[model samples]
Target: MESVRTTTTRPAAWLMLGIVLVALNLRPSMAAVGPLLSAIRSDIPLSFSLASLLTMLPVTAMGLAMFFGLGISRRLGERRTVLLSLLVIGLASLSRLFLDSAPPLIASAVLAGIGIALIQALMPALIKSHFPDHVALCMGLYVTSIMGGAALAASLAPLVLLHGGSWREGLALWSALALFAAMAWQMQGAGSSPVAAAKAGRESFFSNARAWWLALFFGLGTASYTCVLAWLAPYCMEQGFSEQHAGLVLGFLTAMEVVAGLAVPAIANRSRDRRGVLGGLLVLIIAGFCGLILSPHHLGLLWPCLLGLGIGGLFPMSLIVSLDHLDDPQRAGGLTAFVQGIGYLIAGLSPLLAGFIRDRSGSFEGAWWSLTAVMALMLLMVLRFDPKHYARHIR
Candidate 1:
């Protein structure tokens, strides 16, 4: 395998565009379904437990698929792997158009999850290799696009249903976006590159204490995020908001995430260490969780905005912190894959558990309280994540 060069003599606008487009497709399939879930349940007659699986299955698949991403990238090359992932996303999303029952819908989610996992696992490396000089800027753009995609889908799904489309059509329309990304990626003509293999005698991240801490922090943070994504709109509807209005509130929350996703990284990048920043964000998350539990209906806009700001900052910062732990890009990448793999697996269970809580208690308050506890745990976890402590572990 040939090593891919990281430095380039000139800027590649096409490559950046392709990256943004691919990022845009990453969340719509999952996000859109959540807003329209009520309509879907009405059509398909699914129980709460099964309905929760709609989100859980894809997330769980993504978690599991992360372990395979590097191998797939090595075999197919990064460019081809990404292109194939896009094709899979497009086809899987298209399948939703005809899927009328829970089983097939869950199957489509699984397929989309595999594609998403591969692309997400591979993309940061692609960005680092192709846009070394502008890695932060490109990454901020990519992350913002992902949140923006979710916001757009959440905002649009309710409208799609209101305008005479079924839940199937609402979910399936995202395939067009995926197909567009596939075409755009192909036009870049990006060639494949060899993935760096792990050193022969290095200790596995699985056994490292700091690694698990980071993964736990990431998982807890994502649990809060996935829980809201899967349940917020339904919670709002139960509180007397219309489906379309609930969707808009959910959209607003994700839009705030887009804002923080772009801003927080740039702000954190200038600081010598992220401890203060991470601490402050966690405070905001705790406040948001409290607001939701105490008075969700009354403080509609405030709580979501606060939650979005905190989560948006936390997600990217966690990844950046992990990368900062190791100077070696390959080692950092490996730790990143490990963290996300475990983190996503843990995060995947959040919605399922939240749904069960909702079923048993007949309210989402318990779920929100559960998220608050998770965030509190995340706060404690970060105290142990001081970068100086991990200096000895650097390769």
Candidate 2:
């Protein structure tokens, strides 16, 4: 039963700007913390294991939220929902400045993650519904801005402290960015109105084995991403890089992701079968992990460069692959939402897993090796993503 569905859209440039700026807000609250973990721990008595919650809590919230986020947007409408999410994020980020202990800090991170999840849930439909002709371009822009925000926060936070500011300030200043985005969203809110949605079928996503595979694939790939995002700076610090330099490496790595996010989709657009490209990216990831494990000091910069190129490409590609599984935007959105839901729940554990490994082994080597193996597993999984299976396996 296809019921009437009404959705409002306008193709103005400000809406595009709104999308990019909002995308920028999604990552900084989480990304800024990794480099400063050493500092945060110094003052707050936060162990590596407990500190993992900074990343894990938010990501876990995001994963859990994806399942219900679309419904929230429908009831509240996307515009107001986006505004509310932004304020939640801004207030959460602002709260970090006053927080004195681990629990409050982590709670704020979860709040920020919920905010990110709410906006993330609505963004694809908003972009696709409004910028139908430019869905690909807008998506690429959205993904890249996410990376760009990480890059900015990672690079800037250390610089702030290096110049004599407190780490709290470094973490909390991102609230200002969220505020700016909130204002921009308010201005563009009228243009991108409520989505007229019809009730989707009650079919359980859990019943689908193919959906599980895609979810696992996306989950494992994200594990690698969130692990690095949470641990890379601290790992580099363990490598004896200066605090500033370690943050820079993480920043550069995320910047490379921004570059790859844009380029990978364009390159993959020329070929329907993305397995070959996926394989190549996995090889880079494996090699980068190898370098990080074997030689911590020599050619240190090269490792993040390679890892950035590989992981960056893989993230967007994972979503693209899931999207490839179905042509209908509505169906693809549902499939991708299901994938991200389970995938992020799986991804959220990685940082905690890495932190636990560190607590046990006294080094991050075990986590790196585990991640390397997982990437290799992903390499093998690519062969299964053959385009021929898409239609047969879906709908």
Candidate 3:
């Protein structure tokens, strides 16, 4: 066994900026659809479950694609895989401009999901490879960009749709972001080798247990966040808030996430071991979920605000943990794919189940309570994980 560090030289500032720029476009296509669900549902004649499916299918697809994405990355290389995914996402997002029916819309969403899966799976590895010393700082910025994109899309999608006179234009706006990401990635390191990267990843990732725990944390944490992302608007509506107000609340919640996204990973990384930090985050999420279930209406922005912050921290911490636990940066990619593949499948069920619970119980409260239960399970899992290192061996 040997350790290799690739030769690369650039100012730290520019590398961070470029990574964030690429990260910014990663989730806009997915985030934009949630805020506009009501309008899409109203215009398209979708059943409640079907409308939720439009949202869940892409997330589900992202997860499913991730299951085999590592093998794909092994063959294609991480950089090319990411670039290819961005191109596919860009094209799919743009195609939504012409879709008036559910099937076409669903297809476009699935395409975007596939692209997102590729990008999400590869990013931590890219960050580790490119910014070995600044994993925490760079991950903070990367997560910031991710939540920033989601917040921007959530806040602005309504305005875009209003001004463009259609939801199609709003949804298609992500295509431009995707194009920019593709160009930035191309210009930065066009000659980087992917086959070497993939080979390197395989040797590093397959022998680790900590990688699996981190992946579980990433998956479960992300699942919780996506559950909220997918349902926040509808929950608001059910509570009697106007669509515009609900959208804004959701936007504000996402904006609050930036605080956690940047701060938690930095804080967690400071300690050699992250279990205490992980425990703290689980507590915050518990508190936030409780807020949503017990006081969402009364506290107004308080519950979502707290949940958003907790979620923000959770996302970056999970990603940073993946990098930290692995001795090799290359392993970060495959580990990421596995985590996302499993996590998104868990998350993909959230919106659908929330809808089912809503229909079954005639209320969204039951859904919130259910989310609280998931968070509790996630907390217990994090407890068994020794965050400073990988599990000694797979038991």
Q: Rate the local accuracy (lDDT) of all candidates.
A: 0.81, 0.85, 0.74
348-385: candidate 2 lDDT, tens digit per residue: 99999999999998899999999999999998898999
Clashes counted in candidate 3 amount to 2
Q: Which 10 residues in a row give candidate 3 its minimum summed lDDT?
A: 1-10
Candidate 2 local lDDT, residue 197: 32
**Off by more than 4 A, model 3:** 1-7, 70-78, 200-213, 387-391
Q: State the displacement of the C-alpha of residue 49, model 3, in Å, after optimal TM-score superposition.
A: 1.8
Q: Write the per-residue lDDT of candidate 1 for residues 1-395, one digit (tens) a residue.
A: 53453335324777778888999898888898777988998889877678888788888888888777877877776678888999898899899888867899999988998999998876766666566555556677788888888899999988999999988888989989988888887776565455363231133688887788788888888888888888999998888888899999999999999999899888887864888888888889899989988988776799999999998888888877877787565566667778888899999999899899988889989999878887777777777766676787544
TM-score of predicted structure 3: 0.90
In candidate 2, the residue pairs with backbone N, CA or C atoms under 3 Å apart (3 or more residues apart, or in different chains) clash, namely 6-196
Residue-wise lDDT of candidate 3 within 1-395, one digit each (tens)?
11232435545565566667777876777777777888888889876567777668888898888766656666666556768888998899899889989999989988888888777766677677777887887788888888998898888887876665578888897888888888887675433346645554455333556556666667678777776777787777877877667778888988988887877877876775767777777777788888877777787888877788888888877766656656567666566666667768877887788778877787778877877777788878876666433545332
Backbone clash pairs for candidate 3 read 210-390, 210-391
Once superposed on the true structure, which residue ranges of model 2 sit more than 4 Å away at CA?
1-9, 190-196, 200-203
RMSD of 3: 3.2
Q: Looking at candidate 2, what is the lDDT of residue 266?
A: 81
Looking at model 1, how many pairs of residues clash?
0
What would you estimate as the lDDT of candidate 2? 0.85
